[model samples]
Target: MERKQFLRTLGTGAAFALTFPCLQGCSKDSDNGDIEEIPSGVDFTIDLNSSEGAKLADNGSFILKNLIVVVKDLNGNFVAASQVCSHESYDQVRFTTNDGGIFYCDVHGSRFDLDGAPLNQVDSTPAKQLKIFNTELDGQILRVFE
Candidate 1:
């Protein structure tokens, strides 16, 4: 190949390698990485009977602490996970009971199990697991923490 042609090809390849990740919605330090993140060492409670907590009744998805996805399982159990999609950094994940309770990411169609394990990935890359938090129920309140 001619030197000029080779140089052009190399430049294009380098550009794509650097640009592909951002286009794929990957998180960056200045962008989506901290958009959903909350202050660390946080501990809070949600009243199950309150209007704000109504959306989390049963098998419901609730976004708390900006990045946390709090879901109520079929058995009325509370589970907390990062709302950020593993494939990308999309902060829109919903709980679905269609396949025995899974978190579905609208951006990349990625599915995560209740324990934050990846059930599926939208691309050839290895699936990313979600960050999970601990939750406890006390009468009509649910406490969430890291």
Candidate 2:
């Protein structure tokens, strides 16, 4: 085949190869309910003396355990929320220092306050609130519970 004809065929083939996979991925039946559910009945503890717990000593630092994001707020208070984003149910939520201290989902820019209240709208609708768990610090043990 001529060089121009070969190049034209290659471009069309490449476009077709890229298009079908995206079409299949975007189909309605593609989702098989595999998304993780927000953790419930979540009762766990972290020993502040342990290496993992030591991270909370720094304000604005956070740790992920049992699909939960535990954070020490800027005011030096322990707070916990689900790592699952309420917008898309993706496990990409974490504590951020932005706006003082808030839970942010890296998946779709969903933001929530320390109280788990939605701070922004997603897809033109208000995003759902996060599942905020309770935290109690007894000496060195921090208990996180739903």
Candidate 3:
């Protein structure tokens, strides 16, 4: 390969390694560096039907077990799945993208639908899914428990 092409490929590989540290390339030469992320659990109940839910109706984010919790839409009837990109894991706090279509990873621009389906880019990056918790509405509150 040409110098520029090789460098570009290297950069892409490096970026992929950084984003998904659990991947293969990142496993090599671990003697030089180690990033140990200790997981801590968190719990939160989102109200998807009331003003409080309305207040947090868009791209609302919470953290649990170092896993990002993102809230997309709650139309008082049902809650929309938070569009979390599995590729880049670019979940923001208290903000939702208006696309209402799919979530995009902030790092490599990988896209996943509301159901967490990968749209395009990269064979190494799997077109898998994200977590979708059960939501409930009782009286005036829609609680996403457990």
Q: Identify the candidate with maximal lDDT.
A: 2
Worst 10 residues of 1 by lDDT: 29-38
Per-prediction TM-score: 0.67, 0.75, 0.44
lDDT of 3 by residue, 5-51 (tens): 99999999999878786665556533322222222232355554645
Top model by TM-score, which number? 2
Error of 3 at 70 (Å): 4.3
Score candidate 3 by TM-score against the native.
0.44
lDDT of each: 0.75, 0.88, 0.46
Note each model's CA RMSD in angstroms: 11.4, 6.7, 13.3
Candidate 1 — which residues are off by over 4 angstroms?
Answer: 1-40, 59-65
Better of 1 and 3 by lDDT: 1
Error at 132, model 2, angstroms? 0.1
Global local distance difference test of model 1: 0.75
